[model samples]
Target: MRQRNLSIPRTSVTALVAAMAAVLYLCLAALPVHAAEGFDFYTDSPGIHVTAGDALSFNLHLAGSNAAGSDVALSVASMPEGFTGFFKSGSYEVTKVHASGDGADTIATFQTTVPSDVADGVYEIVLHAASEGGFEDDLILTLTVSGLESGESNFHVEYPDQEGVSGTAFSYSTTIANNTLNTQNYNFSSNAPAGWTVAFSSESTQVSSLEVESGSSKSVTITVTPPEKVEAGDYTVECAATSAKEQLSTALNVKILGTYGLDLSTTDGRLSFDAFANKESSVTLKLTNSGNIALENISLTSSAPAGWEVSFDSSVIDALEPGASKEVVAHVVPGKDSLTGDYVTIMSASCDNQSAQASFRITVKTQTGWGIFALVIIIAVAAGLYGVMKKYGRR
Candidate 1:
């Protein structure tokens, strides 16, 4: 009696099934297209160690499932005692990396070095990669270091050399490691060439000294600028990081390709001169090779108004040594019956890959022509007056 037709009608059952199917479809559609929204931090070589003086780097990979990129902050959650480490993106030290959130992997280099005095041991390290979107990932690293190396310096550098023309600035990125058990205040200095200047900066701020805690490292940028008249050569800049009872020194090399500069001006640096209409004028122009390199086949040219004549005594120079000057007399003739006003003349001197220009302002004076007209009028009036005097005297 209790089992009498307990099932629903066929239509009702079909409707219920359709409703359930619709609900399932809606749930799937509401989900994100890329639901794998998380970060994975890993490395190909997580366990590596070197001698205390040397260092090792880990190629870390941080992947995000979101199609849009993300910014991930990286940190060393647990570092072994007496160990120094830093993170780098290319040659620059970095605290974060941009994760390629398109399900692709972003790479970072994690560099670590133990103190030169640490004991031989195997240690465990923890690194964390977290993003602002509350997604995070952790990585475990293992290191097996041998006994510490004695009498080793705690200084490292990315690039300690540069090449450029003379009078250019040479920059280097250096890292100072404090591996001792105490914090250190390290003063900075450089013994560069004469008439050269050295500067140090950390985090974009200039600093003469830097402080580092135990088992930590800091990065600094050193810039050396040569003087205006510096010679072309290879020079070594000895940079020093000194603390109480300790000093770390590194030498940086700068190679100058030799500057080649040309300057065209007057003796007094005055570029303006005056010339009368239809009259000839002259200006002594100086062509100086102010660079360290000699200039060859220097060609001098001028741009003036139409029909104007400009001739240089030395239109072309065979060669001019550095720090030497050559005088050229530029004979400028105004155009025939040129307008009485100020005009511009562009004087140019160009050598192989080097050039200079001087702008001269020439004032065309019509007073010279006016003087001749006045003389002609006076002659005519005097002739007329003489003829009239003769004729009237006879009458």
Candidate 2:
């Protein structure tokens, strides 16, 4: 075989090289190939808790590395119930662009306000982004929307704050927030503490569900008043709130200070009577203490007529517990030949050596005049008989 070194012409070699170059250029110029541009949607703070009157916010980002100059436009396709969407106009300037598979990152943010009446619940938002070349992608976002915590609202009493004085009054308020994609109504209630007078402005009947706009908040105030006689110390109340959507509760606290005071009453402290000599009469005295607390160590003492006597069930009362009283008796026996227009004396009661005074009075009168008449008649008869007898003898 003749190894005919058929060397191709230099022109043929150059033309072949030119054709390869032309083919490479055609492939480069034929169409602008687009790398897939995508972003993961996320909340700036993954979970959010807000009061009924609070606002909800979420920030989004397009995270990637290495790739640049690829722009992704954003739009919100779905929003939570109470959220109001607004674009931060000059805010999302394309400072930089990032590719989906790259390691470097870029961020895009959207701001939304939660209405005061937003219902409490978990919500999901969908975000959409499009490239200038008509390529579009979407990200599913999750947000947890919750009502204000018990400690955040006035109606809620937290740990260690429990217990209220018997007479102290408590006032608390509860708020409802719309945190869902729809309108919601809320119901609120309380398991009042013992010895407390509890009242709520919320309906006793099923509360009409309130219409809360998305991204808004609404509030309600509850008032509690403790009973005047509750003992001093810690007390607990269970309060709950429910909406057409959800229910939550808090343990209310109250502190009672001291015991209630006492009031005293007496039916006329003074006593009086009228009697004849050698006659007798009696009188009664009453004392009362009306209070929540006990009265200790009560006593009664008396100074009566010279021959009269007085006594008490307890001359020294041991203790008069709340709402208790005592009655004492006095006996009067007029002395023979006792002359009395009004005989007066003093009576006293000592509570722990503290004394109170009262007075007693007695009046006396004498008996009939028949004895002197009989004696006079007898003397007249004797004188008449003596005169008759003397005259008869002298004749």
Candidate 3:
């Protein structure tokens, strides 16, 4: 065998090696890129369904990867109008969440509220998470709000008209209903005229706030008191119920009835008078209505000592307006043999609703006939003595 010396070219070898390297580079570039291990975010329920004036809640979980732990800031990017939301961990609010290494999980709860006047439709909300380690993620949440078929409100107030006196307390029974699917705490309040006091109570216990379960009702008593000197008229009271999700108010009409009172006294400001036996005396008596309402069919009467007669000019009055006064002449006569002493008589003025009485003192004096008789007797005695003296002188 002839050993022929055959050698390959260096350029060919170089070109072959270059082609293989190019093919390897292309394969490596085509492979998928792996993300760095940091934080992963997810939720148990992505789509939530609820009714109007309802509250929805879900659990959010953060899973850690092979990288170091980081603090993730959580927030709600967008929500419907008149909607509110918050995040909580255990019993406290969670503004920032922490994720540990070694594939640990951190959980936080998210709560959202739907307003009572929200329309029936599907809404979208965005939940976002960010960290200093160049970690950012967001998830889209779906919220479905439905309305009742009967078109009834979730919260309502029931109250009726009330009536009372001006200087007294007015009370009424009210009912509040929670027709939603969640329990709610309601605050009670009212608006009234100036210088008026209002209060609320439940089951005979005073309360500023109360709690009612879902689809249930609560009985509340509202008491309103007007000012001590308020005028008699028609008034209105507005009572309200406030909660985290809804507010309701109702008006109650109040009718005020007036009070009636009468006062009786002597017109001359003297409770005593002087009279002799078998004599008649005249006195003036005054009657006044001091209350807010008018007095009708007012009658007068009197009580005197034995054998004494009392009479009035007019015994009955048709009507007496408020704060008005009337005067009547009263004629009083003593008995035939009345002794010289003080006498007391009670005069009363009465109306339909009220009455008053006053006492009068009368002092009796001796008759004039007895004085004339005593003077005649004294003159006769003097004439008789003069006659006797003259007769003796002549003898």
Candidate 4:
């Protein structure tokens, strides 16, 4: 065996070493780099229990990476069939979220709904968050759906159907339940028709919010007042109870019962009349039923000056139908010694639940008998004096 000793130049060796170093640097640069910290995702609730036809919500938090921030888009990658998912921020829905490199965390919310006809079982929901910079993370949430037992719900509202007259206040007894394990503070509100006033009261005191313990319920009274001039019809009111965890609503139907009213006036549409002292005056009054129902046993009454006699032709009426009018005659006799001036006599007509009033003025005049007697006496004295003067002149 022969051995050959081949030696390289210093420049060549130095050049080769530099080239190898460059190649190593390039290979290392081509490899993926791992950072000390990166985008992280977490949620407060990883497992939730709900009933069919119910909704579940949770919050998701995202911590930014130390090196750079990213705009992450969130979505539900997979879920059970007939399940609907929503991502929201305060009151608006959002799909993409932005985080800064300043070490601050961003929060997003997730909501899922289970269909009413779904079977009771455990379902897995996969949530994915992908960044524009190629950073991706996935989280798994477990959902357990069960059939709703009797009188069991996350929240509920109970009310009775009601009927009331227009312009009247209607109250409903409503029961609210809290079926969760934690005590909840719920805010009470209502959506009513225009020109209506609605309020909620607990234990006779008006309240805007109330606290209910876990697995307990409270009864609240909801009062709905229609406008003064509302027409007779059917109306609806929607009442809601809201909290951070849940929102519930119920509708109440109300049928308005028409009101009863009456209008009383003279036949000439006049509310006042004139009369003479010591004489009989006749007046005609008409009663108009302005209500929706018929009125029975209509009666007439009056409050007149002292020593005045007032009589009605028909003191009691048999029946008065709605949108109909009936006339009655009144005979008013002023006192013999009634003074001359204006005097008022109030007449009222009432039937069932309705009543109306009218007034009349009486002007008493001096009797003509005294004036005629004085004139006759003056004429007799004048004639007698003239005869006496003539006889004395002739003597």
All candidates: TM-score: 0.50, 0.31, 0.46, 0.55
User: Residue 21: error of model 3 in Å?
Assistant: 41
Span of 10 residues, lowest total lDDT, candidate 1: 144-153
lDDT winner between 1 and 4, please give it: 1
Q: Compared with the true structure, what per-residue lDDT tens digits does model 4 show for residues 35-54?
A: 32255666767887776676
lDDT of each: 0.82, 0.58, 0.79, 0.79
**How many Å off is the CA of 149 in candidate 3?**
7.4
Ten residues in sequence with the least summed lDDT for candidate 2: 151-160
Winning model by TM-score: 4
Candidate 3 per-residue lDDT, tens place, 22-94, comes to: 9999988886332332455668678867778777787777655522467778899888889889988889989
Q: Give the TM-score ranking, best first.
A: 4, 1, 3, 2
After superposition, the stretches of candidate 4 with alpha carbons farther than 4 Å from their true spots are 1-159, 368-395
Most lDDT-accurate candidate:
1
What is the alpha-carbon lDDT of model 3 when measured against the actual structure?
A: 0.79
Error of 2 at 329 (Å): 15
Clash number by candidate, in order: 0, 39, 0, 0
lDDT of 1 at 382: 100
**Model 3 off-target regions past 4 Å?**
1-48, 51-86, 95-108, 113-142, 147-151, 154-159, 261-287, 295-321, 326-395
